[model samples]
Target: MNPRLPEFQTATATDEQKTILNEILSGPRGNLNGPFLGWIFSPQLAQHAQRLGAFCRYQTGLPLRLSELAILVTAARWRAQAEWHIHYPIAMQAGLPADIAEAIRVGAEPTFAEQDEALIYAFATELYETKRVSDATYQQAVGRFGHTVVVNLVGLLGYYALVAMTLNVFDMRADGQNSLPFAE
Candidate 1:
């Protein structure tokens, strides 16, 4: 069944609102959840908020590939089709191997480099299944990945996990496909 779209009272956008909406559109466009987003005019406040969130994901300085792995695990936890559809490729482009991406997408144990693969999967699974991470898990992550990567990995999981939920709420759709690193 088609998802129920949000029904809201429409009002003419004020100059301030328009400015905020435009800002939101500037970067981190976020997923466009269906045609319904057409209603959200870009505004400065929204843009700034989105930008800040994006910036925070980088606060840890983890390599981009690790960040994407964390995000992929989070996406699977949510079973957010659209979210996975969007990010699977981004993860690959960031250096995630195609086989690993598929394994994660299909919910299998992927062949990954020893510490890197297991660490991300364990963290992601715990977060998804339990909604919280264990201290031992955190310690392992920090021990292997270092402080910065460990923090960023967790943050990235939360960030994309939230993004997946938001996309579901809005019924977001993937824009289009290009060559993703994970493609067969």
Candidate 2:
């Protein structure tokens, strides 16, 4: 499937877009792909999303393993091929076992050895499935991760959900590959 939005061109970009593009290129991300390609159409949105994304992905109090798990949960829920394809290796490298990821991909309940993994999976899955977390889940999250981390976890999941939507709507695939990670 062709992407709904074509790649942005620096040569034809307005001054505002050029500045945003330059920041994205020079920033930690160092590339204009994924949602950035769609966001570049509106430079202000691109700028805010870029900064928020950096904070959510890097500055969050949640550990990388947990955050990546949240992202994968969002990807699986959204059936976002690009997000899963990009982060699967990162999640594995961060110590998430292959079986857990495979379970998520196949829409099965994962058996998590670590309590933290189980907690995050439950938190994310419940939120996505129910649109509101039960009081018990919220308290469990706060007790385990504290208030700050709980907030960050919500923001990170929200951001990745947006990323998943952008990828799905645009039919964006990583590296020009054309295969669905989760069966529809």
Candidate 3:
């Protein structure tokens, strides 16, 4: 699918949009892509989303590997091509097992080497596939990570899901990529 909005450019932006865009550009992401391109149409929403995304991707209580795993689950579930293209490598760099990542990419169950990875996989997949996690899964996560981390995990899931939805709705895609790994 084609992009619904044009790519953001400083010269064409209003002062407020430029300010927000510059702020995003200077941050860890370094450049805007994916849903941000479409979100820039609403500067306030873009700013707010970027901030939330930063927290989910960087500051969440879960480790980077776990967070990236959850993000991959969301991306695959949504068949979000751009999101998968962006986060798959990041997840690998963060130490998510290649086989596990590949399994998720292909819509198969992954064998996790770490218990934390397994729990996160179960939690994320249950949340996405069933729309709710079972009591056992909830308690297990809470027992291991505590309430705050669990809350952050949920927040991460919700935030990325929003991003995936935005990208899908806009039909945003990575340049030069032919198709996403998973089939609908």
Q: Give the residue spans of candidate 1 off by over 4 A.
A: 1-3, 6-12, 28-49, 56-59, 146-149, 177-184
TM-score of 1: 0.72
> Per-residue alpha-carbon lDDT of model 2 for 1-184, expressed as tens digits?
6778876677898999988888989988787656887888989999999899989988888889989999999999999998998888889999899999999988999999999999999999999999989999999999999999999999999999999998899878876556779775
By TM-score, rank the candidates, best first.
2, 3, 1
- TM-score to true structure, per model: 0.72, 0.95, 0.93
lDDT of each: 0.64, 0.89, 0.88
- Model 2 residue 22 lDDT score: 86
Model number with the top lDDT: 2
Off by over 4 Å in 3: 175-179
Tell me which residue pairs clash in candidate 3.
none
Q: For residue 27, give model 2's deviation from the true position in Å.
A: 1.8
Worst 10 residues of 2 by lDDT: 175-184
Look at candidate 3 and tell me the lDDT of residue 99: 93
Clashes of each: 11, 0, 0
